[model samples]
Target: MALMTTDTRYTKVAIALHWAIAALILCNLALGFFMEGFEQPLRGFVIQTHISSGITVLLLSIVRIVWRLTHRPPPFAPGTRGWEKGLAHLVHFLLYVAMVLMPLSGWALISANPPPPPPGQIEAAPAPVPGGAAPAAAAPKARRGGPTKLWWVIPWPKIGPIQRMGTTPQGIAEQKLLHDTLVERHMQIAWIIIALLVLHVGGALKHQFVDGQAEFARMGIGRGRRAPR
Candidate 1:
């Protein structure tokens, strides 16, 4: 419905995307770290499911950004001084950039990977990656965060590259190294993004509960117009 702020507040869509993405990203971060612990993992099963989920999230995020560009959001409360406003904008900008980049990097990293089916792991006929993924039960809303959370996955554009490698270990090492580097970059950016999100969300909550302001509402419901005093 209404997307613009009439009285300096967030619209419903913006609020929903903000919180939903935040939760998703946070979960992804936790999972990415957890995945690292699994020394060797299997595919065509649980891992496949997980990767598929990631790709879905990534597509939605891209959609969210396009939505953001088309729609104008509500503003911070009047009491939001210069520094607070600046910080909020900065945090949001960084978040958006990281969100997009995280997945793209993963996709590229996946692309760079040299595909040699792992030892003892048998290769199955390649699945068609509509957008660089398997033709699956459901599209990947998979977030790549467990290890990378570029969470920008519908599982993502990784498997196709592997398919191209065609079980050749010839170029696999270089691809693996490239993939590792992309993964590392994804992790580093994620930490920064997480910290910023924490600060942003924490500050918003503080303003809402402690400072007794309607900052959160600005992003939750469409901004309400006020009567002249």
Candidate 2:
């Protein structure tokens, strides 16, 4: 791997976090779509994974933002255009917005819905049957949405009264409405993020190949060539 000189490249930590978050976002996007066809157990598992990955992206983004504030990005490659630079900055700003909003919206949506039981706790036993040998299973209830345990291991703290609002008919109906509205917003923003990513990557590749700039290298991806001053 050819590394750019420190003067012309991102710090290793920034590069690492950049790629890691990119991979996680891409993976979660795919999983979100993929879960549509899955059945109960598998769907539940995939949704949990998507939520966990998204939350991880949110946390990493926070750290990356801090790193960015303290550290200057590598200087632009030689001959980069004013319009191109403006567009790049715009895309980056939108990306940060999406990164911050996507996960928060998802978490909020989950919080607004009914929460699931804390990790590792067995669901309450079904009420006893009136006269049969086997106890009747409680009627399957609609998922109002709720606190999601991360990686099926770490418990996210219960967030709001919304989680506790599902016990009554009116509350359940209200929670479901909130859940649907949030899901729509979350998905719309996710798509916008993906579109911004396409533009961001397309611009970088254009610079790398069409413009003969070592743009990839500036992000620690490939070999760098020094431009004459």
Candidate 3:
């Protein structure tokens, strides 16, 4: 069993991961909202950045989970009610679920409906012949649905089964339906994460300001106070 500690603040590693993940989540959320306004290459770049951030979050979250399992966090501040503790735990659990599922559902959506060819991949039409008759245009390169690069660096493969879904006409229809469903789920989970964040931050502020507890200090943000008995 992990040692139960009376330590007032989170360990350095935990504190680092917490802030890093929070920053990435906020940035990715902004990217998701604004990406549509961008044109071609720029839009693609934004999307690649978002995907890279999401994958990073997933990896860091796994590390955080392992760290949590092995290291006991400080107990609740004194004067905390039983209901408050229960709500805190529930909100935390849901947040974890949202973080993991949001990226995965996005991955599935893209796999089912691969993005269009990136800039410079599509061939241009052949110039008009001497008689003012246009020769046959070259066939555009096949859309193989290539892997998404992490921040335009490391290659990240899509989910194979979903990536291969729309080869045939019948399969195309099925893939479209699946893609639509995943899109809806992905948006739904984003909203859930937002709501949970509000509750989590609100509770922390309440403890710190309203109840006179050193809440931020427990997360390694500020100076510690004596735990209420």
lDDT of 3 by residue, 1-229 (tens): 1123345777677788889988999998889888989998898789889989998898888888888889878888889999999999999888877878888887788787533445776533334334433333332233335578887788887887886655444444456567768978988888888999999999999999999998998777878954333
Model 1, global lDDT: 0.59
Steric clashes per prediction: 33, 6, 0
lDDT of 2 by residue, 87-155 (tens): 999999899889889998888777765445567954443333234234323313545354468888898
Least lDDT summed over 10 consecutive residues: which range in candidate 2? 130-139
Best-fitting candidate, measured by lDDT? 2
lDDT of 1 by residue, 69-122 (tens): 887775566676798888878888887888777766655655653344457975
Q: What lDDT score belongs to each candidate, Candidate 1 first?
A: 0.59, 0.77, 0.76
Query: Per-residue lDDT for 146 in model 2?
Result: 45
- Residue 178 error for model 2, in Å? 1.5
Candidate 2 Cα misplacement greater than 4 A, ranges: 1-5, 115-140, 144-147, 164-169, 225-229
Candidate 1, residue 220: how far the Cα is off, in Å: 2.5
